[model samples]
Every structure is written in C-alpha cells, then in structure tokens.
Target: MTINRLISGALSITAALSLGFAGATVATFTAAAPAEAASTAGGQITRSEVLARAQFWVDDHVQYNLTRRSNTLHNDVEGAHKYGPDCSGLVSMAWHITANAGKGGNSTDDFESWSGKEYLGSLHDLKPGDAILKSGHMELFAGWKVPSDHGQGAWTYSLNGGPDPDGDGWQDDWAKGPTPNWKGKRGDETWSGLQAYRPIRYKNIVDDPPPQSPPAPVYQTLGDFDGDGKKDIAGIAGDGLWIHRNTSTPGNFSTSGVFISNGWRTVNKFMAGDFDNDGKDDILGMNYGDELMIWRSTSDANSFSFQAYKSLGTTWGNMNKVMPLADYDGDGKLDFAGIADDGLWIHRNTSTPGNFSTSGVFVSNGWRTVTRFINTDFDGDGKADIIGFNGGDELMMWRSTSTATTFSFEPYKSLGPTWSYMNKLLPLADYDGDGKKDISGIADDGLWIHRNTSTPGNFSTNGVFISNGWRTVSKFIGADFDGDGKDDIIGFNGGDELMIWRSTSDANTFSFAPYKSLGTSWGNFGYKILTSAPTD
Candidate 1:
C-alpha cells in the first residue's frame, strides 16, 4: 500500500485499540501544511513544547519514508512541502532547523555533530524533546511512563519513522515502540550506540528559574531523630547538631526551623539506629580521641534532647570504617560493626543501649584489606552476611557461618570486579520483592544497582540505572524514606545541596523520579549523614 494509506491505517487501528483505555487519546492526522518556524523565537524550548511540535506531524498525514528526505512544510520556509520527511526530517522539523542545518533531513551521523545540538552520553539524560540517534537511524525521545502495575523499569516512549518492515511505505504511530533499556548494542540494533542531543536555543525565551532551596540545610543521615514517625535528617558541624524535620512530603523536610541543635562537634564519623532498643533512633559518634559517644534521643520524632550520654571506651581510637547499623546477632538490640587496626570487630550490644562488651573482636585476618562493607542477608537465610570490597576492587561476600558473639564467616564468594571505585555501597531492600536483597553502589558515574540474579552471590551487570551527571555527588544514602517498600536515593550534590530521588521501578532495577532538592550546606554540617525509618 502507499505510505499515506499505511499511516492512515495505523492511526485508525491505534484509535480503535485505544477506545477502552480510559486516558488514552488517539492522534487525528491532518493534511501536511507549509513548514513553519517553532512558535517561540530563539530561547531553549521546553521538553513539552518539543513534544508538541513533533505531535503535530503525527497528527498530520505526514508519510515517513527512509529514502525520501524533506523538511517540514507547515510554515513559509524554504524546501517546504517538497517530499515526505523521514525520521531525521521529523526531528529536524520539530527542532526548527533546516534539513541540512542539523535539525532534520541530514544523515543520522550528521545530526550527532549538528552545531545547534549538544550530545548527551546516556539515555537517562534524555528529556522529552531530545533526539535519540544511532547508526542509520534516529528517533525523538517522547519521555517515559511508569506502568501502573509493571514490576519493571520505566518504558521509554518515542516518535520515529523507518524502512517499514512489512513493505508498507511508512506507518505512523504515537507510541512507536519500546526502546532498549540500556545504552549499548541490542541484538542486531546497536542501542548502546544511541546518542541523545538537546537543541541549543538562539531565541529570547525566559529561562527556567533556579531551583528553590529547602528551608533548612538538608545535611546527612535522614532518619527519625525526634521520635516522630517520619524520616528526618541529621548532621553535625562545629559542635552543632543540625536536624531537618520531614514535612509529610516524600523527599521534603521541614525548612521552617532547625529541629535540634546541641553542643556536639568534631564528630569524625557517626551513625543512627535504635541502639537502646527503646524503639527510637539515636546517634552514635567518635570524637578526636577516638572515643565513642552515644546521644540518646529524649524527645519525639520532631526534636531531640540528650536523654543519656556514655563513652563506650577509647578502644575505637584505632578503628575506622564503621559499617552500617544492623542487628547482627539476631538479638533485638542494635550493634556497632567496624574495621580496626587488628581486624573486623563488632561492639556487641550487651543487651543495653549505648553499651557493648569489652571484647568485641570477630574475624581478624580476613578483614584488614576490606574497603567497603554492608551487613545484610544476601541469601534470605535470616543471618546477616558481610558483602564488601576487598581492597582490590573485588566484590566478596562473607556468608555468616555463625551469628553468635563469636561469629564465623564462610569462604568469601567472589562476585567479580569494577567495584573498586565505589565510594558508597548499601544493601537495597528486596526491590522486586523477590525475597532477595539487591545491591546499590555510587561510583564516579552515578548510582548503579545490581539486581540479585541469583541467591547468595550472583548479580546482573546491566546496571544502567542512574548515569550522566551523578559523578559530582559527594555523599549518598539509601532508604525507603517514603515507606514505598523500595529504597530511594538521597544524597548531597557537590555544593552540599540535599536531593532525594524516589524509586519508580518495582523490580531488581533502579529508576527514580527526578531529584527534588531539599536544600544546601548539609555537607558543611559534617561529612556524615544518617538515614533511617521512623520508629514506633
């Protein structure tokens, strides 16, 4: 059939298919008009506007032909109404550039170097109006959708034309098809070769205003500090205890006032947990003398006052790298795990809050070279496992052979390399709810999540989760701050601005909502930020 008939047939089928879908709307194709310049003169066009322009063609009977190159004919522009535009032509027209000037009728490779556009490294950097180009092919990224019940990553939506597989001239469809989840080669198609680009505007458009700052500095450890049932933030700076209370929003914290301030300073490292098992989170820190101190929360989840203070001892002086808080012994009390000059040790909670056994040494020789570690149940065996980097970038897991005071570790299982540069690692709760704990790491590129493909010691290397500009993140922590069952990414930008990215994927993947800035100067409060869920 002719290209025009094919596109019309496709639209008819689409409209018919969408009838029962409540919110679905079918595009009404019209005759092609003269090519016109974009509505606004020169400033950067918003993603929405870009999509709108592209949709105009989809709604028009614009036949797509790979070999037939033509510019948009909606306005009184040169080369208007000449030939049916192809995939690249559609993008060029939407971007308001000549087919030869990099916006439309040029080769896919030419668009990559088009003067008016900037190359984006990953698909994660795509905005609605961006273009996704690969060898011999190109498409307009039309944003993404989080399926109502799909336990997977967000599905990418796009607009494009092609060498119609069925010998049909060209079929126009709004939801063209699903793109590959990753950036690399996909089957015969080199999806990894896909490049995204944003058009550089030359018009006088009012730029988007700067992001508003949160009321308070969103400094570290966003846990429940005041005994309230919401996740909060806590940071220490120059003897000042800064707390930002949560204001009911998922990533938002109260900016109205500092939740609490105390005469605590020079805290080199700190963590938060219900050390006392009193059902409320508390703070633990180490000072200049390597002395361990505990600040018991005396107030509700909204505020904090010192209920008790205790110096665990000077033994922590030589120890560093305090692991994440966990109940290692299956006891109801929280314990402190860390690496010391001698080896790995755990300050076993002597069934008392803020108190530990005088002798807290566990596996000695095997831990000296361990760089990063998290105590979690990797196999769902109910016993805590030690997963970490063994100084050489090797990912190794030490399954708990025993959880008693004298814990034993099984022979380390190797999970491969590329783990050395990770600055932060955490055990992500069963993201897919598959009863297996997933792992998340923040490296120079961005946040990466390795879905547990197999129990105990297997992970998928397809972690294209968060990439692009995430290299500048200075600090980050993972927690289901919104009580969504899936862990979220909360971190500080290089400027110490707090940002929270909510999880949208339901499987062993990581796709987050755009980060909402909580505020800045959070890093200035201290290098450590603690995050935890609300306590009863």
Candidate 2:
C-alpha cells in the first residue's frame, strides 16, 4: 500500500521505538507516495459486495472450518469438524472464502495462514480480495460505502468479526440491537444495527501473495495461545491474564489469572510484547485499585507461569488509560507506558517484577483532565517519550533523554486549532522508515498522520487521512486486522458494530469499508476495542 513518507530526523526516539514490532526485523521497506496524497480514495466500498464475498466464501468452504454453520452457540456434534461458530473462527472461514472466490480449491486450504506482520501490510494496501483480521479470524473489506454525506457512512464487509465472522449465518446477541445489558437487561431489539453495507469505490489493489508460512515454534510452552507452541501472546478481556489455544478443533483457550487483582473484578487494559530479554511475552493489566499488575513469563514458551510483582498502588498512582508496550530503553525488552487522570507514568523494566520502577511522571502541571495517553518520541533521540491530551487546546509531550529519569519539559505542543478531547493517536513505524517515527491521529473531523520533520521542541503537521463529516468515529486501535503487516484502523461507530477502515493508498491512510457488526450491538453506549494479535 502507498504510505506517506516519514522524515527520518524529526521523529522522537519514543515514537520510533513504538513503531518497532517487538520481534519482527525492520526491513528497509519503502512505498512510492508523498505525505499529502496518502488517503485519496479512488472509489467507495459497498455493503452488498462485502456480504456477497463473505457468503461466497462460506458457501464454498462448508467443510472443516465452516462444516457445521448453524445459527446457534452450542457444542459440536460428533464428526462435525466446524461445529459452533465463534467470533474469530467465523472470520477465519470468511477470509478463506474471499481469498479464493473464483479459483477452485478447498476454501480453508486455499486461504493463507494468518500472519500478524505480513497481513498488516497487504490489507492496508487495500488489495481487491484481501482480508482484515480482528484476532485469529478475519473480515473482508468488501468495498467503501460513500453515502449522501461523503464522510459519514458505515463500512461494508463480508463476514462480521463477531459470532458469524465467517458469514456462516450464526449470529450473536450483540448482532441484534437492544443487546443484553450487564444485568441481563435488553436495550433495543433491532436487526438493522448489525447489517452490512457497501461503498462505491476501491483503490490501490495489489497482487495477493501466497499465504504466509507459519513461524517455527520458538518457545514450546504449555499454555500456548493459537497452539503454535510459541508463548509470545498475552491477552485480557474483562478478566485477568489468559492464553488463547487454537489447536483444539474449534480452538480452546485458558486463563491463568496470575496477574489479576485480588479484589478487583473488572480489568481495564491488557497487552503483551517482550517486556524483558526473557523471550516469553510479558503480561500487564490495570485493576480497579488504581494498580498496575504485572506477570512475567520466567521460562521458555512451554513452562509458562507468573507471579504478581508490580502494582501501581492506590497511593502511588492509578492508571486507567491504554497501556502501550515497547522497548523504549533500547534494551530489547518492552516497557510498560500509559497515562492516567493525573499525569503520565511509565514503568521501566528492571527485568524483574516487584522491582519494576517508574520511568518518569509528568503531572497535570498546567493542564487539567489528563485522561488518554500515547507513547512516542517526537524527536529522533534513542529514548522513549510520551504524548497525550488534556482538556485544552494544546497537546502534551514529555521528552526523555538517553539517561534521564524524568522528562524535560514542553507541556502543551500546540496543534493551532482547538482539539476535541477525544482525539486518538496511532503511531506506526517511520511511515517513511527514515529512522524517524511518524504518527496518525483521529478526531471528530477526520484522520491525520504527519511526519515530524523539524527539530525537538518544534511543532509541525502533515495531513494523510482527512474527512470533515465523520459522524461519531469512536477512538480506534490500529492493528493489521486483515493479517497484513500494515496497520488498519478498527473503529466502532456511534452504533453497536465496529467498522474496519483499510488503508488503500498508504500504510497509515485508509478508506472506509464498513465491516459486519462485531456481533450483536451491546448498547448505544460508548465501547472501546483494543486489538491484540492471537496466532493459530
């Protein structure tokens, strides 16, 4: 896919580190596009096209993965290869179908195996018959959907990411509006909320590569998620630390709860990246006690185990914001970084839990209401830096030096115009990969990915993805949803379902392809989805 050029010198070290995938080697890959023309869409994607693609695939692969596609969530009967349709499995089936639409072959065998790195790049380029993934499964970007209002419209996709991700006809409670409430309460009873739609245009179609070859088993751990023998994954839902198992014929999963809070039932955030040189992926979760809980995998992949070591105490500081993991220290181990209501806090790894120390903290010195946060080094120094928002016009930055314990200064990095408090930033590797880190932020207006080409303490902007009338673009997370190595944006609309936006022109800039409803619409209330790759 075409991507905006990221200036090498201007990017901050933290920003650059954030873009580095923990394990993937950084290849000198480059795209042929300038900063300004990244998000230009040649046409729109439609809902009908997505449905047709999903249906076609499911119809063809009515074996193995899609063998038993009933409209229920029960156990598989004897000899039923694909009994129940869960969220990811369904999407897996759908991607298999869409990948080999016309070519004659077993749908499951024809589709490529999932690859977190390769898929991100392919889907972001917007290939005609590509798939976007949520986790183990995937969804197709049927096409773009341009409504009467040019920017305000739902994306269309073949197969949803929820129960019937493979478009096997099975649906979930969320797919139906007025989804069951937390208290078993029903809110809305509408079916239209989860239906797919279609767009009119498609752009930047690329040749589909042969499916990715699965990586060798690096760590043969027992509680392997994806059953790949590698214990590189860590996840959290509403619960504590868990491992996903994809080996079981319908895929089995298990939770360790090693990092769970003692009394805290609700979990706010969960992420995994190699936090230490330990090889095994470390797990972190935020609890109700304003505590930051950590679990380290001490041994190789197979012998997975943990003990709660670090806790951002109630007295110390509570972190409720999204926590991003990266090796900011350049030590090859990912560090824990995030923002809270009061200030920015980072826990650098000592490689040992309980002994984990704070990187630095920038309080709400001048600006109040520090809610959301992002970690990036705006300047091209080899230190991890921080960026975030407050209830003010200016954005905040805390720049760290090579050996500094705390960041220097520059509270408000002016964005010129007033910014809606709900702005979200998705910082990818040098969209230019010029050794500098580039960033993409989202707001009510549209998407903006810019290359910081100036020196430290200076401010600049580059516009990549921009649309004026995007109605309720919920804060989204960037992941290679379609299994392409290129990062795609997954946003739940003001409605119940989540929309998949694939970058047609650039790695950061994307066009809207309304995906199937995530499942049943839970409620019209706000929901946040953080995508973590789970291998199979």
Candidate 3:
C-alpha cells in the first residue's frame, strides 16, 4: 500500500494514540436501533448526513481544541465557537453521541473498545463512517476510491487538528476528504500499523459500505503524456484509453481519466516515440490481424487527436515477436525492429513519420536462436545497442557498428549466463547515478536489477538488487517517472493493479524501500508497451 505522505500527520496521531496506556477506561455508548428497525422511524442516519456534518467544520474553519476547553467567544456546542473539538471530540460529535453534550469525550483507546462498534481488522474492510483508532488519535473513515498504481485509492477521512487544520498551530477545524499529511510536530507516523473500527449503530447512521474495486484495465503503457517531465500511465479498457497523469509526486498518478475511447478498442502492442521528429510522442498500434498503424500526435504530448491513421504497410506476419527499438540508425527517428523465425528484421524509418524502408533482415544467422532482446545505449554512445538472451540463458550483446542506414552488429560478446529465470528484461537509465545504463528483469522471484560496472557491457552480480514481493508482477516498464533523472520501475500484476517502485539509492545499488500500488485490475489490458517522446 502506498502511504499518502500528505496524510502522514493523521497517521502520526494514530501512532501516538496507539502508544497510550492500555489501562485507560473504555467508553460505553448506547446501542441505537438497527437500520431495519429504525428505517421507518427516521432514526437511521444516511451516509450523506455524516459526510455533510464532517464537511461542515472544514467549510466553516472550526477551531481545534483537545480538552473541549471553551473560550468566551467560541463555546463547545455553538456554531460561532472559535475552537472546535479535538480528534476524538470531532468523531464524537460526528457520531452525535448526545452524551457529554455531543462532544464524545472518549479517549482514542476508548473508541477502539466502544460498546457499539465492531472491529474491522483490516483497512480493506473499512467503509464510510468507520473510525480509525490508534492510542492518541482517531479519524473517521469517510469512504474509499478504487485502488490505483499509486496504492490503495484515496481513503477519505474526517479529522480535527490538535491545533490547526493543517496540523500547524492550535485550534484547527474539520479536515474532510483524504487524510492530508498532518504538518504538525509529529508528521512521521503512518497508518500501516493502526486498527480500524466501525459503529454498529450511531444516531441516524444506517449503512456503511466498503469501497468498490477499480475497473480492470485492458492494456497499459508508460509515457510523459502531459510533457511534464514525469512519466504518466495510459491504459486501455474496452474502447477507451485511460490516462493516469503523473502528479509529479513519486509513485503517484492522477486519477484515471479517459483519453481516447473510439479507435483504441482493438489496438494491440502499442508503442510511442517521436516518429515525425515533431518532438512529441506519437503512437503506433498493431491490430490482432497484424495490421500496423500509427496515430500521429497533432500538437503536444497532452493532445492526441489522432484524426487519421497512417498505414505503415502491413508486412508484420510475425507480429507477436516484434519489438519496438529506439533510434537504431541514430537519425533522430525511431525505428521498428523485431526477431522473426527467419532472422532479425529492421524497418528503418526513412526520416519520415509512418514511412519505413522495406523490411530487411539485419542479423540473419543468430537472430532466430535468441529468446529475448532489448535495446539500450550500453557504451555511453548515442547509438542504441541490442542485448539478447539465448534459449540456454546465455546473455550476449550486439554493439551497434553502424550509426546510419545499412546497419550492422559487432560480434556478440558473452555477458554471462544468469538470466535463465528472468521472464522480461527491461532497460533502465543509470540507477546508481553511475554514468552507465543498468538492466532490470522480472522472474519468478520478483524484480532483480543488475548494476552495470564501469567496464563497458560488464555488470556486477555480487550485490544485486532483488525484490521478492513482486512475484505476482506479469509485466514491467521503466522510465524516469519522477523527473529526478533516475529511472523508476512500474509493473502490472496478474490482477487489476499496477505498482511503482521508485529508485532511492545513489550508487549502483537499488532500494524499493516502499512499493506503491497504482491501483487494481490493470492486467485486464491485454499487453502493454512503454515509450517516451524525444527530447531536443
């Protein structure tokens, strides 16, 4: 789960509350009528009412006070009161306890054991109007949105400040919506260690439903959709391409929004690049029938009005084996290359968007024998090189010998044989801030990154970066997602979610430290490919 750093303050409070003495007395509350029993009597509270009550304080800027201490101008129960209730007090008021003058003077621990509540156990089981309890602090779980590649979707909450709404000074009002990082003195706490609970019956509250799961994606891709320097995610479902824009925050993407819904339904194996040399990324799509097409961007990265499709001539009979390579000719244009049963073929872009020379086999002898290959600038040269893995798991490299048309490859250099377990090999930029590019892959064991030693084409296997929890990942893409010059890893699980592991290490080593779940069901998208626009 990606912890929303913005809500860390609230989490800190929960942590503090959790440390409170266990001997504190638990509070007791009157058991109200059940929803079925009170529906006709108008005693059941609608979810909207509870939300509205919470929103009121936020809207009016109610002051915060821990002791329910009243000032002359602002009284505890009066609307004009300068200071509102503390964390527990706000929750108590929202529940309309009616006892303690509706202030709900229960301690944080008291709320955990309150007579009329039920333990939810897991945060996934939380619903609207539930209370999140730690020893020193408590917050209302208003609701949740579908999970995303960034983590569990937004978990809405209603909380009061120990001081101000921003958690800065004293006397803050209601904070409605997703919990923001409490900016107060103790902002380092997190909800990863807290407990959640819900009231069986409270005043007019009848139903508290759990959050709905996010829709499954049909296809996914990574690119700088908005040209914000941070890589964003674009997913396809049904006929629509949903763009989850990067928020410029590490591991976070904006809520999914529809980018295109008409012509993308049947698209498969999509790739992006500056095909026109227009400096904006254009899309190339291949249909199930192996019909190749290009969707040229009209203006910028954010605008994709692919009004007309340019046919790239359908000679892709071996479409399933095709791989989109970077500028293979160093001509400032992207090219299409693939391995065929016959040989490795290259369709060199003729310095024109959507135009390619006739498909020709580049490496005829050994191409058909290789199991996997990826393109990257391995020798600090501007030209892209091909790294391949053979069926026997022997890794080799084909350094580019031609920087122009009529491409050629140097003799293969053996790079060891340790990738037998890897299912996918992805090219990542300098991860350790080292000048050399590194290689990452996904296997049954999860994600493994092999740091490149300063020696050209040489990698260090002694101390490799490995993440075991990523066993469920089926596919992965790499990009400098945070605009930090360091490449980050994004992957799709077999299920509906996408996750990101930001790079934190400055040396050749790597540390995922925390993995952010983008959201669920992204695997529904058939296959995903990632490409970025050319930067001039």
- lDDT by residue for model 1 (255-370), tens: 43473665665665677776676656777777766787777876664446666667777867776567766655555555677777647887777746444343476665657788
lDDT of each: 0.54, 0.38, 0.54
lDDT for predicted candidate 1 compared with the true structure: 0.54
Best-to-worst lDDT order: 1, 3, 2
Q: Pick by lDDT: which candidate is best?
A: 1
Task: Choose 2 or 3, whichever is better by lDDT.
Answer: 3
Q: Mind giving the per-residue lDDT tens digits that candidate 2 earns over 173-259?
A: 221001122223221211243122211112333333344643211111122322233332233433334333222111121222223
lDDT (C-alpha) at residue 495 in model 2: 59
Q: After superposition, how far is residue 243 of candidate 1 from its true place, in Å?
A: 1.0
| Candidate 2 deviant stretches above 4 angstroms | 1-264, 269-273, 277-281, 297-314, 318-346, 352-371, 404-413, 421-448, 451-459, 464-475, 482-485, 494-496, 507-536
Model 1 misplaced stretches (Cα beyond 4 Å): 1-221, 249-259, 353-359, 421-437, 442-446, 454-465, 531-536
TM-scores for all predictions: 0.53, 0.42, 0.53
Q: How does candidate 3 fare on TM-score? A: 0.53
Q: Poorest 10 consecutive residues of model 1 by lDDT?
A: 180-189
| lDDT, model 2, position 477 | 45
